[model samples]
Structure formats: structure tokens, C-alpha cells
Target: MKARASSQSKATLLAQHVRAGKVYRREDLAPYSTSVDRELRQLVDQGALHKLAQGLYYKPKKNVFGEVPPDENELLAAFLKDKNFLSFNPSVYNSLRLGTTQLYNKTVVYNHKRHGEFVLERRRYEFRMKPRFPRPHQVTPEYLLVDMLNNLDDLAEDRGSILAAAQRKLASFDRQKLQKSLEQYGSAATKRLMKRWQTAEQQGSAA
Candidate 1:
């Protein structure tokens, strides 16, 4: 009875910390008690949480439509156990007015851990271990430009037109931030492209 009561008490405390539509891991609940494993299993059986992967779990948030999976931020946080990741739907490029209308079916996650593609809760997430990304969780226009160039070879769009569009929009971006991003995260080829672009823009400005 005492052991059961203690387990229940710890579970209650842990439950208070579990937010709906959020992903968690056993390590995340370690501060509450040492019996987190047992209590987490109990919670899973009780339908309070759903197991995602080996150590990953989610608190399902249901609406009239049915259950919704946690967003990429929540899922990746639990998977990597660190928030050091950048995620974006590659399809976002189509909406960026980047002269590409083709839709992609993958959510790319750039992180220090994991490589290749994974399907979580019916959503495709592709993980690539990157040394640097300009920001976490969201894509900025400047970074998008860098990324588009970095993955240019794999893109289905017309490279010439895209480059022309990027050239036209160069002044619309934050020059310093874009330069810093290029210094940190840009590949050799990407940097070369930027250098040429910057030089051309300088000459154009002078003219």
C-alpha cells in the first residue's frame, strides 16, 4: 500500500509537469523521482501518455477532430534530448516566392544527432547532421537563400531563374546577418556565390 501510494504521489507530481501536445522523455522526468520508469509505464497504460519511440512519449491533445501529434519542436526536443536542432518543411520554399512551385513531402531537421529520414506519427521527417544552422526551429529568408544554394544540385527548379530572383532580392535581406550566416554555415560553393553576388551588388550600387 505504501509503495503504491508513493508511486501515485510521484505520478501526480510528474503529471503536473506534462503538458498536453508536448513530447517528453524519461530523462525529462528524472527530477521528480527515481521511479519514473514505473510511473511512466503506468501513465502509458492509463492512457495519459502515448509511447512514441524507445524513450519518447507524448501527451495527446484531442479535439473534436481526434488526436493531434506534437509539433516538430516537441518531437525533436524529446528525440535529441536537446533543443539544438533546426526544422522546417522543405515545401516552405514554394511559398517563399523563390520561383519554385514544386511541393516537397519531407520535413528536414538539421541537428548534431541522427541522419536520414524517419516517419513519426505518419509524418515524414528527414534528419541531417549539420555543423551549423542560422537559427533554431524556424527558417529565415537569409538562411533560406543559403540553404537553397547549398542544396542547389538536388533542387528540381531552374537554377538560373532562382539565382536571378535571389540576385534581385539581395538588398531586401539583412546583409550583416546573411554575411554572418554565410561565414558560419555556408558551404564553400555557397560562400563563393555570395562573394560574387556581393561584388556585383557593390558595382551596381556604385553605378
Candidate 2:
């Protein structure tokens, strides 16, 4: 893409959006028009804006101290914009830094063009063809953690920190709501994990 004559203000706005850490939807930039977009692309090509994926742009974060730059979840989301993506156990697995040290659980899951097997970032991400996704409310932190208990084998430990971690995470959790959620979605993979974790707790106390 070649540079085009454009308002410098639009370019500044684009940079602001990237600085704010919000993913850009092409439509969001509609106010700026095609010419502005062309300049945005040019900016990306010049290494000013990091092109996360088609139409998704970002500005690189400065690495502070010796800590490596954080894994840009926004970039990952942009990278996987095409697939039916969801933040799942993989995110938790990544947060815990528990799986194969060399691997990144991507760790998100989505239905990608109905392909049974696929690879990204040298990691395997699964896409279920059934095209099922939970409502927005169902993917909360508590629910996701419980869901991870089952979907991620690493989180499901027979005698490890999993119980403690889950318990700690859910300690202040509203029992009534979690119980209700369990009843409603228990058949779900995430819900099943909540059950197993509960079972482990009960069994441990009985011992």
C-alpha cells in the first residue's frame, strides 16, 4: 500500500486509538475515510503501527527493566480475528504459566473455518465445528476459571495446587449464584470442571 495525501489529524487519531489499547474496527475508522486508512497502512509499513492482523493495528510497547514486553492479548485477538475466538482455559493456562514451557496455550480457542486441526504460533489451537459459544455473561472470570478446571488438563490436578487455586479464586464467590450456574450449565465442559473441583474438595474432607 502506497502513502496517500491525508489529514494529519486523522493519523493522530489512529495513533491515539492504538495508544489507548483498543482494537480498531474498520468501521470505527469510517470517520477518517479511505485516504486516512491508506496513510494508517503506510504508518504500519513504516513500523510506526504494528499490524496485528487485517485492519487491526497496534503500537509496540516499550519494554521496561529486564521484563519482556507483556503478551499483547489485543494483538492475539487481532491475529485471530478471523476465527470464532473465545478466551478460554488457555488464557488461564497461560496466566498460570503452567503448560509446556515452550508452548503458549495460544491458549485461546475458536472455531476456525471448521478445520479439525490447525496450528498458530507453533501452538495448537482447536476449533469446534459445532459453532457453539456462550453468551457474553457466561465467560466471566469465575466461570472461565471453573471452565478451565475441565478443559485444561493442567488445571485439573488430582493432588496439586489446583484445588487451592480454585478455592482461593472462588472463596469470595457468591455461592448461590455459582450453585445456580452449576445447575444450569453443569453439563457444559466448564461446569463439569466446577463439579469435579467440588467433588475433590468433598472427598478430601471426608478422608
Best by lDDT: 1
TM-score of each prediction: 0.73, 0.44
lDDT (0-100) at residue 122 of candidate 1? 71
Give the clashing pairs for model 2.
147-190
Across residues 65-98, which tens digit of lDDT does each residue of candidate 1 receive?
A: 9998788786887787778888877767766586
Candidate 1 ranges with C-alpha deviation above 4 Å: 1-20, 26-48, 136-139, 201-207
Each candidate: RMSD:
4.3, 8.0
Summarize candidate 2's per-residue lDDT along 1-207 as a digit string, tens digits.
Answer: 233334555575656555533455555566655566666776676666655445655555554552232254554455555534554435444454233123344444544444444453244545453355455456644444444554545433442455465565564666776676555434477665666767876888899
Off by over 4 Å in 2: 1-22, 63-104, 109-179, 188-207
Q: Native-vs-model 1 lDDT? A: 0.83
Clashing pairs in 1: none
